[model samples]
Target chain A: MSPLAAFGTALTALRVNALRSFLAMLGVIIGVAAVITTVSISQGAKRAIEEQISSLGANALMIRPNSSSRGGRRGGFGSGTPFSDADTIALRDLPYLAGASGTIGASGTLVVDGINWPSDVEGVDADYFDIRDIIIEDGRAFTQAETEARARVVLLGKTVERELFPYGGAIGSSVRINNIPFDVIGLIASSGQSSGGRDRDDIVYAPVSTVRSRLSGFRYPGVRDPVNAIWVEVRQGYDVETVTAQLTDFMTAQRNLRIGQEADFVVSNFADFIRARNESEKMFSVMLAAVAGVCLLVGGIGIMNIMLVSVTERTREIGLRLAVGARPRDIRNQFLVEAIVLCLAGGLFGLAFGAAGAYGVEKIGEFAVSIEPMVALIAVGASSLVGIIFGFYPAHRASQLNPIDALRYE
Target chain B: MGALIQARDLRRTYRMGGMDVHALSGVTLDIEAGAYVAVMGASGSGKSTFMNMLGALDQPSSGQLIINDIALHERSADELAAFRNQTIGFVFQQFNLLARTTALDNVGLPLLYSGMATKERHARAAHCLEMVGLGDRMDHHPSQLSGGQQQRVAIARALANNPRILLADEPTGALDSRTTQDVMAIFDQLNREGITLIIVTHEDEVGAHARRQIIFRDGHVLEDRR
Candidate 1:
């Protein structure tokens, strides 16, 4: 028999048992659908995070207490005071600096009227919102004059505003932070969640000057008291590495640290931080792909099992055909055609299912989701390959039957 | 009648439960062209084994088996398949028509296997159906036809290949009296047209219809008479 005849035979046999064939294809449908949805959603998440990280500005540099590995015992810059308050001033005085701010973190429950919400209070000098892409929703951030004068003012994040004063006015209300009453000066717009899904709006703000002088008592000796962490905004085109290097050298000289001894500060580049986040997302994608791969493998085995049972059921028919002059090759082609047709049909349906799955996810998220045509094509091709590979043994058995014994089989 | 088949010392041993069981034991036979022969045997006798060997569906354990002067045992398995298609036609007791296919396609199957183009395959298939008295029933499936009609379609397929030998394995076993007579008449006419035929059956009336009779007991031939 020619290949077409063999194929026609296979197609007819499959059609005869439509329900069983469809059930066999179900494994493929679920497998491909899962692969498409997982890849699209994960890549979507990765893209969102990368976009958020880039919003921090590539040239922005941060100098923390000390690298976490060294227990924050100042090593990369200036003395052993971790981040002294003078590091912020010294970094600001550099020629390439456009602006600078320092942050000290503290958490407290804000009480306005009868409302109480847990909030993160970031002690920042002026230019914090501008440098960090934080938008003020209601009015304005504390002015340089107010920050310098150590005013008792606050800005509510969008979620924080909802929690503390959802019904009415919060701008003029007073909320106590660490039992220290502060005036609500402004509100920050919803920055959505961070790349890590933390709520950006769950925060309150206070002046770094006050945090250093009174509210906070954590200190390392050596610079105008001490600071928690400092971030220097470099010129738009200046490299963070060059500025970090210059600041580190100047800080070392000022604090008088030995060549091999640990300094009190650690400098990190913005580009490196974003790269680390992206690497984490890539690792996550690999893990998802591995899981999806295992599912497809099981689907392949299911195809093989069904096809083998079909071959055994049709053994007599195969023998009769052979007795009537079908060559061994014709017999082989007949069974193979059944398997290939099965998988190819499964693959097409799987593509449709995967497409619909992706569309559903996109509609729910209301964001862009990518469906790679090449990935679907590869999936279809793999299914066909799987059909052939899994179907080979049974088809061979069908082809090798003795025509005489087969004819007499009852 | 011309000599169409010749055989000598044909032996077929079947392994039953990992032990050798001889199904055909040293039997020699000759069948002439256009002769209608009946092979009679009870269950487990060597008669059906002889039929299989003649149909080229099985190889003899030891023997010289020839069909139309061509040695079957010397031929490759594929060559035997081609030989069977070209030389021997079979009619099973079950009628053995592909159940879902139309009567026309069923008759044309041999030609389809012969690589006939679709138009020619359908044309020749129609012709074969008409010859089987199924001209008006060409498109009907086997399930839609009577047992007698289905057997006729099987005969049409057997004739389409224009084989030298027609082997019927209890062709009327499932038929009633009327359909059996109708089928027997068709076989009679085909034999008159000089097509060699062999029928394997236990029915004495069926055996009486053939010109020659060979009876079997166990794995050996007991009697041969003409």
Candidate 2:
């Protein structure tokens, strides 16, 4: 018959079995929803990872000492002296070097006229602000000469400023770090928070040279204890790996470290972090796909069972159709369309639920949950296909019914 | 100018439980256009088998049978289905309308197989119901209609395709005398309109009403008379 006629006839039959048709469609809806939600969560996780990693810095590379021993046990956390002023100076000489910094942090209290706060006091130089995208709310960072000369100067994050110097306009005022007084030279603007809230405005900065020379006495232990990793900025379009290698080699030589002798350091550029996130995203995507696959399989089974029941219940009906001149495909298509419509409607329902689910999880879970349009499209498309594949055999069985036997089936 | 159905040396045999059963034995027959014929026989005399072959629903084991210029035994399954839709209509002893569908939808079923448009299909199906005196029952489901009414709806469905041949296994077999007369009158009216008809029955009265009668005994035709 004409496809329209086929559609009408099929629809009429399905309508006659309204409750049964709805039950069959319910399975598809659940399947589609499961697929959509899984993919959306996986997609959200991937985006979160990328956002976390990309926020690090584009032109910056980090080098931290690998102090782990033979076991899972970690060593002194750094050479305690692997990174030094010599390495920082050498970094400045490189062609692609945009900026450089060596850090030395000491957790201590900062007090300004009895307003006190627990703060992390770290040594920083010219490149620290740019590498971390640290903009000043007021005033400016201390100069290189000021830092080298061991001037009593500091940069205060907004939170640190509020707690240690709540009176406001604390720049150019003195604050005590570990009871050692330093002038607050800058107030850093507020950065909200990460999923981990690691970047809150609650810290300060001093020059690396001053911390090493006057504060910590520059004892030359393991090249210079890294309060933490150092950040090195490269010029735009510069090969970060080449710069990373040069920096590593220079540190190895300056520190008199042996080749493959556990160079006592690790260097990672922007590309490395991005590559890591992409890998993790791909892995999660595959995992979500597998989940969707399982859902489709279950959904298909539901359709098959329902269609089998339909074939059995309608034996006489099938006989009548055959007697009335229905071709095999006509019979097949009628049932197939029923199955497909069930799946498609379910897919639409799933899409709605998935989007809401992702949003709710993101809000309630206090974590980023993502849903990708293409992934959702695939989920829906796959659901319909599953219904067709699973519903095929039952439709075939119904089509193959013998008119004589069916007519007498009573 | 032509015999609507022509069978030459036609035979139909069946295997039941690994044993051969000759359902039709060398039954040669010719039926002309616009003739209302009744096939009468005792049980297992192969009257049903003969009707199936003539309606192009089954193949004869030996010899050729032609209906409306096409070889019945030689046609493919799909071609036979198409031929059935195009040239034949069937009414069973017990009315066999689909239970879930409305009378209108039931009548439109043959047209559904023929791929007619929905609007035209519905219009023609409604018209067929009107002709069968079921115009008011167009929206009724099969369960809602009486036995005789259901039979009338089946007849309307059979006529929906404007088929040249009408095959009734036992048209009045389930009806009371009053309903039987009404159905016979409808059949007579249909035959008068120039459609060929074949009715298979065990009833002498029903057989008597047809213009031609073919009697079967032991899978062989004993007599054919006008």
Candidate 3:
């Protein structure tokens, strides 16, 4: 018989017991839906974390003084010998060092048009904006001349800009930090929230010299114009860990410490931290995939069971067909086609269900999810493959039945 | 004219409980075209076994069985199936009509396996149903039809592929006497139209309708008369 005719016969058979056919397809539907939903959710989470990590600058590393221990008295972190402008400039000439900038920051209340809002204030060199990937949305960044002149010009982050100038016009406006008036020269673009849910846009930036000289701050021992931390940008194609080791060595030698002695500074790479997070997310995705795969396997087994039952129940019908000259291959094709069509139908429904499930997860679970067309295609293809694999044995059994015996089957 | 069916020294044996049970042994027969024949025997007398051999549903252990000039014994199982499609029509005592299907589609079942196009298959099925006096009940399912009407649908299904020989294993066995006469009348009419008929039954009244009768006893033909 032609394949089209075989398909028609299978369809009619399925239609005769529509409810049973749907029940047979339930397992496959749930399986494919689970695969799509889990993959999309995990993929969305990975992308979100990557974006957050990239916001911190992929090639950048932060260096800060470690906690100090002197005479059995331990001090908090960033209490050791702080970095200065000269120390940052010294690191700029190192191999693969793209830029170096010393940063000092303090939190204080800002008063703009009598609206008081508390936020952090940071003093940085001109290259700090590039190292930290901070973009100026409204006005230009302060130049080297401004830093040398200790200009009282400042840049407001998105959150501070929105709060201090709710009706706009924050740029070129004067804001008082620590009761000292400073002009807002630029508005920093939003960097969104961190993975830890911290609001990254609630800060302001000013020249390092301006903040060191104007803003009151304690200085480290014997350090001229001390800064709390130094941010370094490594050139493209350079490894952050290698540069970090070189920086630590340079700092150790600058401090006149022995070769094996531990440095008094700590260097943190954002890439390493995010890599650990990505690994965990990948593990979570793999676990969910395994569960979904098991669901699909169970679904395939369900189809096989149902098809076998169908063959048994229709034994007499099979006998009648064989008597009417149906080839064994014809009988096999009819049952096999029934299975494939059943799974393909389930796959289409599962795609719809998975999309709805993904949307539901994104809304209720507050997760990012997306369904790719390729994923949908593969899901359908996988269900059909499952049908072929599981449906074979029962179909073969039906085809091998003795015509006379099958006719006599009760 | 050459005989339409020829069998020589036909023997069929079964291995049951590690013992041989001979269903047919050293039997021989010949049937001409358009012949109306009945094979009769008591239970376990081998009439049904001989009928199964005649219908090509089972192969004889030792025999020269030829139908329509084709040596059925030498053919493969698949080839026998094809030969049956082209040459034999079968009607069982149970009618063997597909449940949940219309009479028309049930009649077209054979045509479907023969690879006839759907439209042509349906047309031929309709014609066969009309010939069997079931043309008006084409759309009725087997459950919706009476015993006699269901038998008529089965007969029409058997005729769908225009087979040269009709094989019925107790066609009227499951019907009331009244329905039996009605089904037998259709068989007579089909044989009158030159389609060879072979019916298996133990009832003398049913066998009386055939022009030829053969009786079996203990796996051998005890009587053959015209």
Q: Say which candidate scores most in TM-score.
A: 3
lDDT of 1 by residue, A315-403 (tens): 77776687667888788887777877888887888878877877898788665457777877887888788778877887888888888
Q: In angstroms, give how far residue A50 of model 1 lies from its true place.
A: 5.1
User: Which digits, one per residue and each the tens of the lDDT, describe model 3 over residues A104-200?
Assistant: 8877789987899999889999899899888888898899899999999999999998888999998889999989899999999999977567788
Model 1 chain B: ten consecutive residues of lowest lDDT = B109-118
| i-RMSD per candidate, Å | 1.3, 1.5, 0.8
RMSD of 1: 8.3
Ranking by lDDT: 3, 2, 1
* Candidate 1 lDDT over residue span B23-104, tens digit each: 9889887888889999998988988888888888889999889889889989998888888778888888887787687898
Model 2 has a DockQ score of 0.47
Residue lDDT tens for model 3, B41-140: 8989999888888888888899899999989889887898897787999999999998899999999998888899999999999999999888899999
* Model 3: CA > 4 A from native: A70-75, A106-122, A134-139, A152-190, A199-204, A211-221, A348-357
Candidate 1 stretches with Cα past 4 Å from truth are A49-247, A250-266, A365-368, B1-3
- Evaluation by DockQ, superior candidate among 2 and 3: 3
Worst 10 residues of 2 chain B by lDDT: B51-60
TM-scores, each model vs. reference = 0.71, 0.81, 0.90
